[model samples]
Target: MTLYLHLGAHKTATTLLQNVLKHNEAALEERGLARIKIQPRHLFWHLYRDGDRDAFKKRRRTLARKLQQYYKSWPNAVLSSETMFGTSDLHRVNCLYPRADTALRVLAQLTSGMNRKVIFYVRRQDNFIESSFINRLQTLATSLHLDHAQLLSDTTWCSFEHYLSSFTPSQLSWLHLIKRMEAHFGAENLIIRPFESIHRGNAAYAESFLAPMCATHDLELAPQVYENRSFSAKALEEFIRLAPKQGFANLRSLRLHLQDKYPNTSYPRPMLLSPEQRQEILQTLATENSILFEQYFSDVDRTDISYQPVGS
Candidate 1:
């Protein structure tokens, strides 16, 4: 038995991956893999309920029962949730997965006695940060009660630099994540995939990536459906400009408000940058993420993906 955990660091085609897994659950099972749907609400309920001592004891018992059921239900499982990567508190993480070295380790323990593999997909920081800003706003609106415009202006609201600070330059960088995982779990146990290759509407990309991990199962390729929901650079800038004027106290409030008012907002679309802006962003990214552009991604293939605006 083997358990594969896909921890998304946000905006890395997580929804697409989850959708595909859900659609192919039956087929996956034939190959000895099960898709474990750990409801987000359940995870949150456990987290919050455990925060209170009395509630913690009760929930712990309940959670143990749930875990037993889950273990019995699936030998080889695929569990995914992006929130697993959001927190910076190691203690909180430890409380969730006590014996693991890192969050990845905790995942490994969940599937102990079973072969385990971790898969994480990351985008270029320059591109990721820009999308992250809007994502923060969306999160704020959905989770908190703050004004989006106000939150944008609040220095405390959302800052790309501050968010990125959670992980080391290497940890946040895809190349670094790949190298680190390779070192920790051996290349065979870790898989590093580029978001672009998958986005190219190529089924071969999916096959090539999943083949080794799932050789036991005869899987079928499904048509790829690109959501194409990210916001363009201009729209992102417009939102940024609108954010400060609205006066949000924090990111949570902004997201809550947005969710209340416009529940259908999607992730920002990838922005297309002008040549000058592209050059500027590339130069800035070079300062910390030089290796991402120079080594992780080949220059010949760089033109295929969207670019971020400079100085925004």
Candidate 2:
């Protein structure tokens, strides 16, 4: 049985993909694809359960026995979990400090002796960094009653370039990431593609994700409306400016009020990379991006990679 693993790099619409898979489980099964709903937390629990070594040992054996049985019966199974990529966004930023070899190695070990393929969707660096920050700010502000002003004040919370500085060299770019992943899972078995560029001719993004093992391409069983939408610049900025004063009750009430308040209002701020920022980021990653286009995606269309620089 082929094991298809969708190891997500977060903020790349992973939730939408997982939801589509869950909603269309029977359809996928009919097409000879089974979604493996094993909780990744179980693997993580055993990996880090240090307090009781004896207990951990017993738990590991039991889990392994169960997985072996599951693996036997499983047919073209697919597992999707963004956490498997080792991305962490504590306060709306990827403060993901991964011990590169260790984390991915654990994943490699779990799928050993099986025919496994990994599907990873990558985003433009600047766009990813900006979207990550915005998503983090919104999530933390609503859930933790965090003050935007204070959160911004923390020197650690800076631009995406600054964010990259904190990451290990291997975690800095998708090129490096793909390199590590290829090392662990072999280059031929890894399917790396631009998250933005791979939707050609597909009715929905989820269909593209399931393309590797699909016997049939009927996606009529799934919903195409993207539920988790991005906050417009105006809405995102206003939410940050106002989050400072909100208590638990106010946070929820104020957010609802804002939604009602600006039903059709245009944003005061731009949510994505400014043209200048995008140009600079491209320049910064030019070499790596070229390598990415050349290596893994050589046979595919290069339209997205051909984005024009700032001044024509």
Q: Best candidate per TM-score, number?
A: 2
Please give, for residues 169-208, the per-residue lDDT of candidate 2 as tens digits. Answer: 2234678778888999999899887777534532446666
User: Which digits, one per residue and each the tens of the lDDT, describe model 1 over residues 31-130?
Assistant: 7667766657443334432445566456445644554555577666666776654421221121211222354443444444556677766566555555
Please report how far candidate 2 places residue 253 from its true position, in Å: 7.4
Task: Return the TM-score for candidate 1, rounded to 2 decimals.
Answer: 0.61
TM-score, one value per model: 0.61, 0.76
* Clashes (candidate 2): 3
Q: Cα deviation in Å at residue 269, candidate 2?
A: 8.0
Global lDDT of each candidate? 0.52, 0.63
In model 2, state the lDDT of residue 40: 59
